[model samples]
Every structure is written in C-alpha cells, then in structure tokens.
Target: MNQYPDPHQGEPWQQPSGGNPGWGLPPEPHTGGQLEPYGNPTGGYQPAGMGGMPEPTEPTLDTIGDIAITQNTVITPSGRFPIRGTVWTTTDMSRTEQSTPVWAIIVAILFIWTCLLSLLFLLVKDTKTTGHIQVTVQGGGHYHATQIMVSNSAYVQHVQQQVNYARSLAA
Candidate 1:
C-alpha cells in the first residue's frame, strides 16, 4: 500500500522506483470502487438514452401556385392569440376599375340640354310673318302640315317623359 502514488497527484498506478515487483495501494476510501467509470449508466434518468435528443415528428407539405393572392388580418385586443402564416406563389396582374355614378351622368345630360336651349333661343325669333306660314302650307299641302305638327308635339312629350324617367332613376 505504501508503493502507490497519491490520487490527488494525477499519476497512474505504477510501482515505486526500487520497491518489490507487484506492490501498490490496494484500493482507496471514498471513491466507492475504481474511479475510472464515473458517468451515469442509466443515461441520466432518461428512458432508453433519450436525453439531450429531440423528438421525431412527421413531415409537412409545402404549397405552390402559378398565381396567388393573400390577405392577413390580426386582432389587436388583449387575450388574443398570435398567428403566423406564409403564402408562396408566382406572378399576378389583376386590377379593378371605377365607374361614373348615375347622378353625375344625369347632371351631364341636363347641362347639355341647357346649352342647346340657350343656343336655340339666341338663334330663333319668337314670332314670324304670316307669309312664312303660308309658304310652309304650300310646301307640304294641308294634310302633311297637320301631321307634322302632331308628330312634333308627340316627340316633344316623349322626350319630356324620358327626361323625367332618367331623373327618377337618379334619385
């Protein structure tokens, strides 16, 4: 037992320089047994050596497309959970166009009508000579002149009804 070196001196088991051939310290106290095999044999309380290892999980599929549109919304109040997502795709070339409103179209029609009425008022006189009327009677005879008066009045009434209908639709 006196031939072995001290364990605290970092020396392996060896015979003293000139001692007997097969002599060494028998064993030490406080080391349980030999100190060579010191790590946990049960994998540090893990089942079947699963310590320091991640669990195995199933594989997931990735989505792809030629054209895609994506929108995301989030709730900002408390007690709401977080959301994470992604969209994968290629190119997109779509758009939406605006149209003129019905009221604007009606106003345009009324403005045009006012311009035409002003032009007509400036060009035509309110009264004419009876000779001009007699020439009109000679040009178309009596029956055709009466028919023209009736049709002209009917067309004016029809135009008035159409204008009223358009105004109602605008409202």
Candidate 2:
C-alpha cells in the first residue's frame, strides 16, 4: 500500500492539503457538547456553558422539610446530634369521624316516594379525618419529635417515608 500521496497524480481518497487529514492531531471536542453528571445515564445531558462545566453539587444531608439528616448527624431546629444508631417510631394520633353528609340528607328528603329505600341514602356515612401523627425519632444521644397534621392516611404515609429515609441516613 502506498503510504504517501503521489505528487504526479492526485488521489481521490487523499486530502487536498493536510498531514494525514488530522489523524495525528489531538481529538477536538464537539461544539456545545452535552454532559452527563457523575457519568450517570439518568442524570441527563446538561448544556455546556461558556464558563465550562460546573462542579456537581453533592448534598451534605438529605432533608425533609425542617429536618436534615446525614449518615452520622441529624439536624433540626431543636438541635444537632451525631447519631450512631437510629430508631424510628410513629404514633398515629389521628382520628377519622363518621357522620351523615348534608347531601345524603337532601337526597333522602327529595326522593321519599320509595320511603324506606330512599331513606337508605341517610345511611351513607362521610368520614372526615382530623388530628395529626406524632413522628418520634430517637437514637444515639438525643431525641426529636414532631407532629405532622394529617389530612388523610396518605399524608401520614408520606411522613413515614420521610422518617424512613432519615433513619437510613442516620444508620
């Protein structure tokens, strides 16, 4: 194979004028290239800025509202304790009250031709939740408890998830 371009006859594959068509040069970056943080595929590509790529911001603590939890530290308005082992407990202080809705009473009164069958609407009970759940987390050398207002059972579950994450961090 001929390594050098023939001076007498220009070859179609050969560059018009260049040293091996940039083969010996360093790789050039693509203009406005995309970047994924920490090589995580799910992080997605961020647009390259004129100032270049920014440093990734690692969280010092995982936070849930006012509470910030780390592997060895728990921070809250009450205080910060360097916890070694963590324990979590939740007290369901919430209560749901059962009552007849006004709409049910109205339906029963408006459709009384069937009498007993229509009155069955009055048996429809509407449940309303009231109160809060007391989430208490205590371990190592200190304890902190907070009350989260409960609008429904799902809200309590959300609080529980937060507590669970904190517990994992504390551990």
Candidate 3:
C-alpha cells in the first residue's frame, strides 16, 4: 500500500486548505447522556446540585400579607342579609397537620341543624295544631298582618339572635 502526500493536499501531518477543522466525521451525534454543542456541558438534566433541580421556592411572607378576611352583609327595610363570613389561611403541603376552629364550628352547625330538623319533624307530627298570630307593633308597624306560625318560639328566637349578632359583627 502506498501513502503519499499529494502536492494539492500537503504533508500527511498537515491539514488541507479549505477543509473543515473536523472533517466529515459526522459532526458528533447528539446523545441524551452527553453534552451537546452550544448547550450546557452538564446536559439539560439537572441533578440535586450543580443546576440540577431548582432550589425549592418559598412564598414570601410579604405576599402572605395580601391575604384578607372579608365579611359582607346587606340590610333591607325588612331584614339584614349576611352574605359572606369566612376565614382563609395561606399554607402549603407542609401544613398538613394544622388545625382550624372553622371545622369545629362547622360540626356544631351541622349538629344544630340536625336538632332543628328533628324539632321541625316533631312540630309537623304533633297533635298540637299550629295557629297563626298577627300582633301589631305600636309605632313602626309598617308591615301589615304577616302570618307568624307558632312552632317552638325558642328555636326561632335563637336563630334570630344568631342572625342579629352576625349583622352586628358585619356592621
């Protein structure tokens, strides 16, 4: 076999004129495992360190201050309407074990609702006939004879107090 350096090419050790620095060796094929040209030498995959996974981002407490508790109410000539009363807390997965009094209050509400339903059922089934009353107030008796059914005034007064208290708080 004869290996000769042509005059047009130069000595075998020297590079040829107008030839690419890395001649047609199929410009290194890209691999997921290996770094690519014009790409991060560490590849796109980020390990725990060295720009691998992003540092766990934390929400700023300043942004936390944006959270607000709102209570809304509306009053008409007849009665007051409590629109919204809620408590909201900002938290993440780390607060799984946290407790709020809202749940207890909700349970108490459910229990009271159950008791009220039972009382209503009793009122419906009891032999005591329900009679309507139309008592006229002295000066501000603007509303004409409204049918007020006599069925356990105790619970009615209790609910009215709750609604009034809620109205007061909103005011």
Candidate 4:
C-alpha cells in the first residue's frame, strides 16, 4: 500500500461524470412538492383532488380590544361573562391615613437620651393608603368578582375609568 495514494486513482465504482446529481434515480416530476397530497407516481396512490379527504380551513375569531372581549364574551381576571346584557360594579375599599414611620419612632427612642431635640423625629408624618377596590360582573348566567389593589386615590379613579369603559362596551 502506498503512504499517499495517487489523486488520479479512486474506487473501481468512482467515475467522473456530469449527468444528474440525483442518486441513480431519474429526475422526479415537478409535482407541487414531495409532501403535497398528490398521488404518487406509482399506480398505488390517487391524484390530489381525487382523494376522499376534504381540504382544511382555519376558523376565524371575532375579538374586541387586545384580547379581553370577543363577539359574545367578556374575558376578565375572575372569569368569562356574556358581553350582552352584562352589568359592571365597582366598590372602593381603600383608606388613607397619616402615621409616624417605624424608623422615626426607633430613632426618637435611641436619641431621646442625648437631647430633647430628638423628640422632633416623632413629628415626621407619612400618608399611606391600604386596601383594594372590588369589581363585580354578572350576566348571562354567570357572576365573578375581582379585586384591584389600590395604592392611592388616583389609582381608584383609574379603576373607575376602566369600569366606565366596560359599561360602554356592554351597552
């Protein structure tokens, strides 16, 4: 055996020829595609349209807004409700109050031993809001209630605006 075989030499079956790149088989017919439902070249398969199977069609959907509403349904966080004859209700359950922060109380206690000026820290006031608004929808044999957390009166007003939009949609 030679360390480096001559490039001119190849297997007995190897021959340089530019006929068809297809492996030995003749070129296939230009049918729509290989995976098309057309009949095979052989007699076993039937022609495309001759088959008993029906052509498939995609179902179209009617939607409103981004994805919350459809032709007959109003999708919500709590559940789906009928858009027709639907009712929307909102209740504000938030309360706001002013109080001294825990850090301020702690600071006042730690510095009270040093001087009377430390008592001023107790005067620091913070306004905080806590609670959520409950929204309820009922119609077409269904009922659902969902709560939207509110941090301030502005957010409560925003929720009211959204409910108003829903009312318009229902009407």
Model 1 TM-score, 2 decimals: 0.16
Candidate 2, RMSD to the unseen true structure: 15.7
- What lDDT does model 3 reach? 0.35
Which portions of model 4 miss their true places by more than 4 Å? Answer: 1-67, 70-72, 77-81, 102-124
Which candidate's TM-score is highest? Answer: 2
- Put down candidate 2 lDDT per residue, 57-129, tens digits, no spaces: 3355665546667666666666555646767788889988899999999999998986769999989998888
Q: With candidate 4 superimposed using the best TM-score fit, by how many Å does residue 58's alpha carbon deviate from the native? A: 15
Structural similarity to truth (TM-score) of each candidate: 0.16, 0.55, 0.18, 0.45
Q: Write the per-residue lDDT of candidate 1 for residues 20-119, one digit (tens) a residue.
A: 5444444455855444444767433222213646423323121111111112111111111111232111121222334555555555566766565433
* lDDT tens digits, residue span 1-171, model 3: 324436675544454434545432344455656455466675553324224545333332111111211244222234222334322111111111223345455555667765654333322222222333332211122221132444454534543444344434434
Q: Supply candidate 2's per-residue lDDT for 145.
A: 79
Each candidate: what lDDT?
0.29, 0.70, 0.35, 0.66
Q: List the residue pairs that clash in candidate 3.
A: 46-52, 47-52
Give lDDT tens digits, candidate 4, residues 1-171. 444334585632243333524323444566663463345554443323315553232232332222255546676544454577898898889999999999999999999999889999999999888899888778877677777788888888877887777777688
Candidate 4's displacement at residue 146, Å, is 1.0
Worst 10 residues of 4 by lDDT: 58-67
TM-score of 4: 0.45
Give model 4 RMSD, 1 decimal: 15.5
Better of 1 and 2 by lDDT: 2
After superposing candidate 3 on the true structure, give the runs of residues whose Cα lies further than 4 Å from its correct spot: 1-70, 75-150
Clashing pairs in 4: none
